[model samples]
Target: MQAVDHVTLATNNGAIGGGEVMLLRIAEALRELSVEVTVVAPATPGGVAEAAKKAGFETVQLHVKNRLSWMWQLRRWDAKHRKGVLWCNGLVPATATWGHRDRIVHLHQHPDGLHRVLSALSRVGAVATLVPSAHMLRSVPGARVMPNWTALMPRSERSPGPDAPFTVGFLGRLGPDKGVHVLAQAMRLLDEQDPGRYRLALAGEPVFVAKSKVEQVEQALAEVDALVDRVGWVRPSEFFDTIDLLVVPSVWEEPFGLVAAEAMSAQVPVVVSDAGALPEIVGSETGMVTPKGDAPALAEKIARIASGNEGVDVAVQHARWAENYSPTAGVVRVRELLDTLGA
Candidate 1:
């Protein structure tokens, strides 16, 4: 509806990840600003396309078997019929449409190895390149920062009681990269020193993880199985309701910590490892931080958060800080990006 006339947003994967969540959020933001938004995604699994259509956007469902097929199909399809701004929402689509005109490349995670090679080629002939955090911008120096947002969560006063076990929540994939194994070790240490002092509300499953690593995590948690409530995948709102605090202990460099931000928005205390943007999301003033993969340090942080008073103070500052990453803030960011391109 603006100067660009139309905007076609493409997805990186058929299965939704943090990137897809951002893709959907930005699509809504685009529509709110009166931009014509059409989502391009693979037909199967169909998470991204379905969510977009449900939110009242036109969807171009590509008939494809795997990511490779989707890339080739989308690349061939766009060359013939593409118009207006083609917002390539991930490296897959960005590389697919490389050398094409008026393209915006958005990379959701830090590129490594083969992806680093592809990302270099993917940015050619694009209008702009975007990553989710300033932490990401360090590695991806040329890209602009577009922090991911959550639908502003309703604030709730939640904290562990005087006698109740302090409940810790983890809301990402149950893979080593998320530091789930590290958290399990921390829990074991917590139990060994101060028995029954903590409980973990594990709220994710192993997706896109190796079977060996998945088994490794299971074995790691086996010692404290009674203290863990393995709730599979859950929305942040639902996940936050069940715990006093949320921990994002990623071992790998994360592009953005959306779950940590959502925890802040919900007025729930959060702890993050010093990996990539996790620490950046919750600075010294807003949330807790621990050394990456250090069980003793993580356990000690959990041991320290034992009262409602500590939770109340941290949650208050966190909610205010989180305002910058809310959906409202996201709309403003998107508008600015659109306006810049429009100019």
Candidate 2:
């Protein structure tokens, strides 16, 4: 509630995961609170780190490659800096101390052993976990669920014109698990039914190690690439302007699927797989959802939306997203945790 001196946010590289978005929001809100915020991490760039540097925050770079080394560096940083609150935005190492009782740890939906490791670290007594969805809270028990915040794009409110093509866009890492191929298969099916009824756009970068998979998909798409436009990564502000409907066809359970909320805020209807936070994030008002890994059902929903027959209320979706996940609301919850830290 009072003026806080400093906060340091450490997050994974956005080029790899979704944690950077949460970190960027926290940095912006804390900076607005007049806190001198500094970010420390590895050399990777984009997402929150890019946004933070643009907003004039100090960033320190360290070369801790794995979780073990990351923690060692974090402890050294915390010892030297001793800021108002040592905020661990994602996976990194930081030890417990009187100084960080109620220390803030923001979770961004990890999977496998990663989530287990982070959850165990969070339970080490000084950490107060901050996650973005109930599913995420359930994954990491006792973690507070806070909405992922965003500074809406200036053009996010611009309604798609009547003549604008019925476009559906998919965002996030393009992996088999993300169900990119499944979505593509659905698109191919729909294209056969009604040629040019809708245009599908696949945005976001391919996973780095997915070289072989990417080549395979590209070769497969050569058979019918015109049906889907595979646009690579773009800036954050540029993401919402190109689509009318967003689809997240994840085959696996996603922790928060912030893209669903992002689409909701942009007033774009969503169709996601009913896995993990996709169900929680994409309620009935926001969008229609299909069973995970079901391409035919996804195709059916896409056809319905493209036909403009589903009657999804865009106004209601936008209003709900703005109310629940606005930067103001997320920051308030974060600052409440900081208050418990004696900030």
Candidate 3:
């Protein structure tokens, strides 16, 4: 057996978003494979510390915010806990765990500038590096592509709501880079073409800033032709039930669009940008894909699905998701990687 005595997972677990959920799932999965998992995260808002205790894992909530504090914590970890493997979520923790080069580094984002420099350094020092897509592979040499997975909701719920104002749901953080402006533009375009046919549901929090950021997003929404219902940050369990069609118009090059996979698992059709890993997430046979930042194309596709002119088989879409991103397959792949690491 490989001498992986302990596994430390460092991530920003603020309990406000999906990253925390991903970290928890990964930790649980690793534990099931007989690895001693320890999650070292930022302190959460609620009783998550107690919850982690109930789940039978040790959690160290170091209240480290900025670079200087993080670096101090890293120096401390390096000095004390010198054995075991370290798997970090993103740049901050990855660099923090840099002193332990013999372990693996699984990078979640396609970093830029200084972060990119750190990632390259990690690649040179680590045993293996994991990324989510081919687009991300260009940023990190020899990085193995492993798509993100989720505990899927039932597929029957993917169908559009039969008795509502034709709803187009925009789910995900309402940050500037999340392409909320593009979604707003598309809603405007669609409302102009068919005033009574389409309505929008904006779900998730404004991650760009605090109170001012939400006000900015609200002001941006005012420019749109219609008013949208804003449902702030939702749990993964509650996602598919609240929407008809999930539209992800990401402006940036996302390493892996987990929203697409989440929607697909429910057998719902998605309208997403052609940028980054979106096309790979929502395969052509399953959902409608348009060019990045093209509001008109987004509107056109939304109109096609809303009007039922383009007969979208949501069941077929769910089948495509089942074929590829099932939790069973993901665990199997992870186990194989573990074996390879041992060998």
Candidate 4:
């Protein structure tokens, strides 16, 4: 490892996504500990570099035609000019800068097939190979867990009425992989059991989802159209205020259930599926869980919870636990990681 004068954070995307969001948060964390940071991203989409500058860091935009071009350009730039430890925010940057020493390879998602091989190659001579959750260790066994954290809401704005229909909320992409279809199916079953007893408030859209996938999910949700309130993209606080509880029914394995954690922070009860790190985030006592893609089981569970107002009794208590993912705790964790890395 070289001297710890500063850290240069390389983003995985030209535009901002979940990994890019964490890159900014990590920069903030490092700056809090008195480490200088310079953010690097592609010039085409040009989001991450611009955002880093706004966050009070130096920024570098690699001129490129596309994502693949930006990657190799980043490698050349780092190899020729950059100093200090390189922090790769995802597999792209990590693989690009693998030959360099004193670098941290952070995997935001568990890769499979060809990507799995790339992940292995990205680990050579790294300070650490990091993943966002313990569940990821099942696939990336050699990586260390670097749990993602979130910004806490000031106070819970939840005020759903007791007499009103039990409102279930979801706050991610409205695609099948997120189990939007499964949720719709469950809501339909609940309606059959007790008509007008339950409803859904969806706070997201199919931004990155393919057109065909979106059509399938929409078709499945058509049966429950009247019961569904599509609220598009919204702030977590605003979304939490309009519902009695939040549901994160991801069908694919989740690297981290950040939305579930955000719901907990806002004093909203959560119903998560047993998919990847979701259960790890909500835990057994703080929230309820059902089998992934099982509409009947999910409907039965939601029915019991909606039948009474007792489901949210642990809301406040869960909010207390959610503080573990707060910025202050994130700073502490970052400090510990850096110290262990001898930075």
Candidate 5:
């Protein structure tokens, strides 16, 4: 097969989030392999275009008024620029690039209702359809599983021992679906059992959410205000440094848990709710798993880790991350796929 000369990564979201983050990382990885890469996004404020530019990538911004407008603009762009492979990063981009022969439709979330048909339509005429987890593959039949990876952090010698108060941390969007409310409830339960034994540290603010949902999250946090440390937006390294245990209590099925992988990459112990691919990402030995949306179960698992009952080996966790969720591992898989597709 002939080599693909360049790759154009098209993102659906205007804002930078997990999917967009993956797009940036994949672009950097492909560039390192000597392939030319360009990012195509909406010409709007708080979109991927500025973020891609800030990261020193070549980018193209389309004058997209909304989703429908973006789809038309993307299709026109793909029609004009057909020499290289077009990688559609989400549903909108996938739909935009529909019927393009040298295109890859990558879906980061499971489709439901009308989205199911939209996802199917997006895959038409594409070379491949990819998802981040095996769990997600169940939703999109014949889609290849491509697990996500995080940029590795420097190994830190931080662990909660018997003497210190066990710091329980929650990082990610402060929204209802993320289960921040459940984490708050779990913290309250733990505090009732033994006051001051556990402290809750929260990072991230609500984004792309309804005002009602934001208010609901705020109200939930208010109930546990005494034990909550609202450390607004902080770097993952800094957040990991302050907490001993990381909790990813998502109610929605997270296609892939990037934060959990980052924690495991740093060799920090984690407790993840059994939602989507979280259990698969964290594994059995490296972290604890609780039932989804169950605060008492989450609290119990947190307490077990705090009391040193759970056997979590940092070395093992690091090894798992190195083997599966490392940047090198993810890059290798992507490069192989691109090579197969001649891209």
Candidate 6:
């Protein structure tokens, strides 16, 4: 097949969330293959556009009045520049590029209600529909599964030694749905059983959420404040260096557990709740899984690991990450998918 001269990756969100991160990573991978790539996102706040530019990719910032404005702006943009594949990174972008024959609609989350309708609408006349996991494929029928992955983190020189504190860490947004509150509850349970035996470290800020939800998360964190260390908005690689284990106790059905993959890449053991694609990503051998929103079950799993009752081989987790969630593997799959589309 002949190589496509250029690919335009368009994002629905102005903010740099998991989907935007995936978009940038794919752009990097495609660029490595000598393919010309461009990123298009909203100008206001310009989070995705700015990050794309910082990463050395060409970027176009559309003057969107609001979310709805992107639909018309993207349509106008695509009408003028339809030379190569239009990769819609989410529902919004997919809607914007609707009915374009060279478009690929990629949905990073499970759809419901109106979003389900939008999901179907976004795929009309597209070359293909892509999702991050097999579980997500069930939600978006006929969509191809392309598992998410993370770049390998550099090893920390100040790695936790045997004498270091047994730290339990949480990453991602500080929201109840992401289950920061659930992790906080689990930490409280652990503290009740054996006070000062474990330390809870938290990274990330509350984002794209209501003020009430932020307050709810704060109230939950308050319950475990004495045992918590707030490490606000740091790189996952840096955050992983200070912790021995990572817990992703999300209450919602996550499309894919990117934090779990990042932790495993850092060679840290993980404990995930069986929500959405989390259990599917962690599998049975590499990490422990508990019922979603069950603080007691999560506490038990943490206690087992802390007290040496649960044998978690970090090397095995690292190997699993390398085989499945590594950037190399994800890039290869994306390359094959694009090849099939002749893009």
lDDT of 1 by residue, 136-176 (tens): 98778889998888876775556556788888889988999
- Candidate number that wins on TM-score, 2 or 3: 3
Model 5 collision count: 1
Clashing pairs in 5: 14-47
Query: lDDT scores for all predictions?
Result: 0.85, 0.70, 0.72, 0.86, 0.87, 0.87
- Residue-wise C-alpha lDDT for candidate 4, range 151-219, written one tens digit per residue: 875445556666689899999988999999999999999899888888899988898899999999999
Worst 10 residues of 4 by lDDT: 309-318
Candidates' TM-scores?
A: 0.94, 0.84, 0.87, 0.95, 0.94, 0.94
Residue lDDT tens for model 2, 1-343: 3444788776655343566656777888887777788887665444445666676889776665665665666667677765566677664533322244436666676535755755575556445677778887666777787777665544445566676667778887877778888888887888788787767777877766378877766665565588777778876447667777788988777877777777776676778898888878767434588988888999998888777678788777667667777777777876776666555
The candidate that wins on TM-score is 4
Model 1: what TM-score? 0.94
Report the lDDT tens digits of candidate 5 across residue range 1-343. 3677688999978788889989988888888788888999888745689988888878998887888998898899889964488889999999877888788899999999999999999999988899999999889999999888898877567766767788999998889999998998988899999988988889998877789999988898898899988888999987898898889999998899999899988888888989999989988444478889999999988888877787778778788889888989988988888788874
* Winner on lDDT (1 vs 6): 6
Clashing residue pairs, backbone N/CA/C < 3 A, model 3: none
Model 1 clash tally?
0
Where does the lowest 10-residue lDDT sum fall in candidate 1? 306-315
Candidate 5 Cα outliers beyond 4 Å, as residue runs: 159-163, 285-287
Better of 4 and 6 by lDDT: 6
Q: Rank the candidates by lDDT, best first.
A: 6, 5, 4, 1, 3, 2
**Candidate 2, superposed: residue stretches over 4 Å from native:** 1-5, 13-17, 43-53, 63-70, 94-102, 154-165, 219-223, 236-239, 284-287, 340-343
Residue-level lDDT tens digits of model 3 in 135-232: 89888877888777777776444455566577778888886577788888888888788776777888887764568666666666887735588777
- The predicted structure with the larger lDDT, 1 or 5, is 5
RMSD of each: 2.1, 3.6, 3.0, 1.8, 2.0, 2.0
In candidate 2, where is summed lDDT lowest over 10 consecutive residues?
93-102
